[model samples]
Target chain A: MSAALRLHRADTQPPADLAGEFLARLDRRLHLPQPHRRQVLDELACHLDERVRDLMVTGVTEEQATRRAVEELGDPMVLARRFERAHVAPRRRRIMNMLMVGLASAAALTGAMTLRAPQVTIRSAVYPPPDAVQQVPQKPLDVQGLPPDVQWGDFFSLAASTSGKSPVVHWGALRELDSDNFGPGHSLGIDPLVDQKLTLDQFLELINTEKGFVADNRIEYREEEGRLVFATTHYFDRRETRLVTYDVSELLRARLGGDADNPDRVPGAVHEIADLIRALVESGMWDVNGGSASITTYGTKLFVRVPQRLLPRIEWVLEQAADAHIGAHQGASVDRRQGDPLHTPRDGAALPPAAGSSTVVSVQLQRVDPAAARQILNQAFDGVPSLKQCSVARWITVDASSRTVSVSATQRHAEFVGRLLTMLDRPGADVVASAESSMQVIPLARVSSETMDSLIRAIAGGSTLYGREFRLVANPQQNSVIVEGPTGVVTALQELIALLDTDWEEPAKVGAAIGR
Target chain B: MLHKDAQRDQAELVILSLLDAQGPLYGYAISKEVSGRSDGQLRLTPGVLYPLLKELESEGLISGSVEEVHSDRKEAAPDAAEGRKRKWYRLTARGRKRLAARIEAHRTWRRVIDLFIARDPMDHDQKEHGR
Candidate 1:
């Protein structure tokens, strides 16, 4: 018996009543083996006893301490459920194991099928000679005298008989191509058979389009010892899926600004860019729209897989979009600064009267305390001439409880206030105090070091202190980028890398909430 | 109040690191140590603490041993005969390895988050004006 038990024995109204009742409830709910249940109850009882004893030492009465200890342990039913989940949930484990086994078996089967070669049959066919063969002694067989299918059969049979090498027919490929519905009229219409002495390559080329038995550019052939092997390149073959990764971080950085005001803004921007690319490019070429192409993003880079021919088009669209996005920002900034009527605030705020347009905007602080943020905003607004003219102090309101600030001022002054609030509400503002240079090696999991190096350079180049205050070296062998700079910049770079190094696969939802 | 899910995620690493630093400790001592170290911000209730300990023990990351502790109230009460049981848990070799990996992961996560919240140094003028 512990001191707690002795205390319980001395008092008629024992504090142990609360703990004992809680344990009993827990014991009833636990579905564990007897020994395990006993062990758990014993451990929890010991913890409760210690807590009650410690509280009693602080001058609290036995009953109060016991009740407090029991309450702190939480509801006995919840604890019992957690215990059961930890020790008795074998059914969930069994289901997960079954799923793993099923997936492994499926993957293994797919691998085996992919590795297996298609079977080819070597055979020769001879077609009966056409009637009235106006045998021009040195000339090739005249296809104009017979039906197209028969003419092809006659030429093929003759070529197979004389070539010494048996023709290896890919029956599976032939059936597939035939099922494509390429009817009789889709022939190459070239007369390679016009000359009697044609090379093997010339003969193969002619047969490549014979009544479309095999479509042009889809057939590949080579002489294999005593046989000629022919294979058809299926359009849906895995080999046809070309993976191209594009570094679009620079373009995004330019459009969204070097430091985005909203944390969600980066993802939103990425989504918008991806959507634009998908919409501008041919719809029939993407996997999302039932095409063979697929687009995925990891961090700031776009990973696109389409036919080799579609690569040029995708690149062109991204380039055009980047140019348009950057140019729009520049043009909009200039127009806004000059108080051009055409570039008025989208909120329908009235244009400025000689000085500047005035608008009322409410900004909710995400990271900073609203009370402190308002005090700071008040002082900053007093210095701006345009804001002062609009009587900024009278128009600004801060609601600390809701963490929001509303301000009415000239367009430029209002925009400045919003930008200031964003800067103040940064996540780790305290950690940026150290300006000492430090070297950090960031190991990239998805993007290559060379590619990351170029992106880092692009970002660093935008800074005024690039070569002097900051420097970076990419180690391709290690697949890591070594950045030497002030702790703040390095920290920012790491955050940027983490942001850009994600696997974003859903093309439809990428940046879907842009203007909203 | 911290979110329950977030608290649970941090609890594992905190427990592992505590055990590694302070050696073997029983349940109550572990709870007190955590609360004391974090200035009472992290109070590991029995519900969250016990299940995690049991799970860790089941996974062989930590090992628990039961000890019979005799009461000092023998002279005060004749009916108190059976000694109470106190289970002490210690970090296993596997737990130490897990702790190292978890610490690295945590540091990387912190660095990323810190950077996300850090203000641009180029905007020093704005900060000064606000001040």
Candidate 2:
């Protein structure tokens, strides 16, 4: 019998005297008769007698000892409580075990041990696409993602793949770290590169080859006129060490309408930019604010990071180019842009760069709500299966078109794209390579805010963003979309817009760089 | 031989009250007292008390000490020699207090009942005569 049940038995009779020993002290926790009490003593007789003998050593009379033992035993209430707690879990386990036993017994009576499996499947969905809006002329086009000012053959000019890669798995789900083999019992995994294992060396090697950089970037102060410009320049680049002289002096002298400040920065490409500024002014597109022109310098590529100022003019030039090339000469479907959130920016015209600098253009919409911006970003991953469910909030996105890198938010989204960058970043995450990918945000609210007037002010100012395009404008009437981009880029942009609209049924949001 | 536990009622009132208050006791310690004074009955049972102790414990209102029961008896039969056991318990404070109060209330009832025995024989007869 369980110890608990025995203690519960009445100690009133049987060895009725012994009953006095345990029962007397037994809390009248339960009221019982002579026989019932005896039953308790019978069960506890051995124990009671042992206690009696123990009291004998305390120097009491034999009878007294037995009685004292009973008295010393104290409260039955305490004993009852004690016994109950000790047995609860065991009792529960026993009940489960007994249930299992009963099931097994019934099974034995029949004789079968087969089990059945469950079924599973995969699913997908897509929304409607949008229409294209009108185009605003572009002055100096945003040529980013096309590889520095160098002439590119095509988008796939540098399509090379590297090997020695490992299949990635989440640390939480690593095979060797299986729960059964975990805890203090297990030692280190035998092979570093086992099924789900990765060695630090192999991981680091992957990062160096794939990630390409491990240094922290710093912002340098350079004097543009008398103003201190907070700009990030890779001063460590080996090429910056050499002070090479080119015919920049002669070019600056011939091109400048006024005195030049810095002489050292001039030379090869600076001379070419000086010549270009003269051409834009002659064409009358330069917007002169007071006596100064908004001159910004940055590399020109399909996804280049142009300075924040010239984005308006650059957007304008791209629009003009696209207007000229798209539809008519570029053909009906040639340089189409996915008019996802296409609109003309309200900013002044493009102007000449500072004396000797190659002008870099940039555009940005200020106070972009993180949520709206995120929703807009979601447009990029719409069709891709893995990224369809990816959180726009948590993805490390690089807008090759805008030259801006926004950090991904972590927890909110669970799509494969959620971990894409993080997994590709540090040594642990085995990202094979890093490349530029451009995407347009949908919904003006998704880019800036649903608040219209402020969004307009934000676009025109152009000072809010680092490298952003003009403000996005929507003609609630025609459902049109207009954007500034090279004719080909604009065409592609239109296709992207159409894909979104056709897939999502959203009206076109056109973007261009108009006068401030 | 079994007449040993006759004082159980007397001792029980006190013990139950303590159990009611403190709730659930270990074997040997339950044989000792935490609160409440002893009656003249020399009734302390470490051995036999354990089994019955174990019994009432199973009935639930009270639980028992789980930490291995150690026998502090320096000299013990091998059957009982799992030395130096300590007992613990889980008691609803309500149960202990109630038990403790019940013991006191029961004693008061017993004292009232005793008044009948102390009454004059004639009065006792007349009291029952109301029937």
Candidate 3:
């Protein structure tokens, strides 16, 4: 037989002496007559013995069989009670059963009452108090106390009214009355909504609306030069007559820094000049606040608007800016291709430096429209696709009608443009030649001599950037890394250096001045 | 063996049915016969079955007689020389009627249990419609 079956057979085995012991226990518990007790014992003994015999047939030991047989009969006390129930007087049985029923019902009632009772809960702490309200007046506090000599209220009143000389005069006289009265916290921000990209006319209109100036610009095509010349006049409050005329043509030619014989050189130069004009004007425009004038460049001229009293200061600032441009142009290395006979200047030797230190210089800009300027720029870029690798393109823009260009790029881009423009002046130089000639020495700034040496070693030995081929000369004496390669590669190194040092200054800032 | 209470109520029926089927049987023989018929699932001991037998005899559902018989054991057997007297029981007319009634009640009970145990087609239809 299987192990489980054998175990089951053993489990069902009757106990050997269980029946005899059970009957004795029952007999002691039972209240029966003598003859009846004798008869019951005899029958029960025979039944138990027979049960054991039957269990033995199922392959259980006699002892186990007898035990199982007696166990099957249930507890002795319980069995004796059952027997008593069957044989006892009916009246007594009824009383016992009634008592059991009464006890059960009482327990059930107690449980139901316990479940129906209301539950008790512990509450949380009270809510927090509200915050204090600020005691502020709805309208602004009136201007009360004032110095006898200065009329700050009079100046603001004039400012809130007509855009005329009275307001400008009062504001300036007040400042002159007490220079330090407003304290160091009196700085003002006069930012117009110039966040969106705008054309020169739109920008001028916005300035006129916001700052209350009258700006008028005109582009005239000259048959003699076969190109257009742009000029703009600015009047203060639409009343002042003595306007400043900013001639961008000379500035543009100076920025281009080469002979204009090479067709490629003229367009690139025009683009750069327009960019430089736009940059200078935009900088002057946005940075204008107290005692500052608003200026903008379109085509070949910069228009300025300022109060009569502040006109001298504005002109002085403009002269200084012009001088800076002249200095950078004169400092630029002469284009070696100037001697190339085929690429001789068509309009005489009118190079950037030849413009002289005149207060105002004018020349023919480009005859092309804004679309043509973009096409030229795109053409220029097609020859030098690597320009797209860096973010320098966003800083330089071109306008064909005004033939104006603007550049607000980093110092690196400026240097690259300088080199590219110089190369483009060559007779046979295309965009590629100009692009390749973008090689220039980039000075490292704010780097310790030790760090500079290590970086130079890392770059030269090809270890710092994996798989990058770098050609760099480390000048410990100057504390600069002079790099000569494609503009993109040079820019990558610049970015890497920037990543390494947050305080690192642009090498272009430390190199040749802005105009150059 | 069933629970004591259930055994107390059904023991008389079991004995009557046994006697009706096997004819007259002594106490030990009846017990052995019960165990055998149930494949040893039910066993009645002296303490339980004896009282039930006496109750049945008093109720007139069964009648008992004292029988003197010779032992069928071999001469070498331990109790062969000793003759024993045993009380034999047989189902009376009233006992037979009671047994038949109880068996019918059991069949009715089985049918009632089937109502819950078996899957009703109406229940399946109601569930499908509800879904």
Number of the top DockQ candidate: 1
* Candidate achieving higher lDDT, 1 or 3: 1
lDDT of 2 by residue, A245-317 (tens): 1122333333331323344333322423422332232212222212222333322112212222333434433
Worst 10 residues of 1 chain A by lDDT: A121-130
What is the Cα-based lDDT of residue A224 in candidate 2? 28
Native-referenced DockQ of model 3: 0.08
Off by over 4 Å in 1: A1-12, A88-516, B1-4, B73-80, B120-131
The clash numbers for all candidates, in the given order, read 9, 145, 22
Q: What TM-score does the first chain of candidate 3 have?
A: 0.19
Off by over 4 Å in 3: A1-26, A52-78, A89-516, B1-11, B40-47, B69-82, B110-117, B120-131
- Per-candidate local distance difference test: 0.56, 0.33, 0.43
Of models 1 and 2, which has the larger lDDT?
A: 1
Give lDDT tens digits, candidate 1, residues A1-516. Answer: 233322222344566656776777777667688888888988987777788888889999878988899898886756776776667443333223222222233333343123333232112111221124222122333344444334323443344445555666554564565554332233323333443355545555545533323232365544456665555655323344566677666666556665444455565566555655565555444675566777787666667776554556666656665555343432113223422112222342332222233556556777767777676555433432222333344545676766666665544445444544554465555445665544456655434455566554543443322124555555543445666466676666665554333222221122122110
lDDT of 1 at B86: 89
Global fold similarity of model 3 (TM-score): 0.27
What TM-score does the predicted chain A of each candidate obtain versus native chain A? 0.28, 0.16, 0.19
**Candidate 3 residues A1-516, lDDT tens each?**
111112122333334234545666666655567776666655555556556667878998777776777777766555555555556533332222222222233333343122232121211111122114422112221223222232433323322232221222223322332355322234211222223344323433443343222222221111112211122232222223234554544444444546534454444443333323323332232222222445454444455443333344434433433334333233233233433222212333232231112111111233334344344334443433222233234334443444433433343343334333322222221222333312223333334333544544432344232223344544433334444344455455554443322222222322223333
Candidates in order, TM-scores: namely 0.34, 0.19, 0.27
Kindly report the fnat of each predicted structure, to 2 decimals.
0.38, 0.10, 0.22
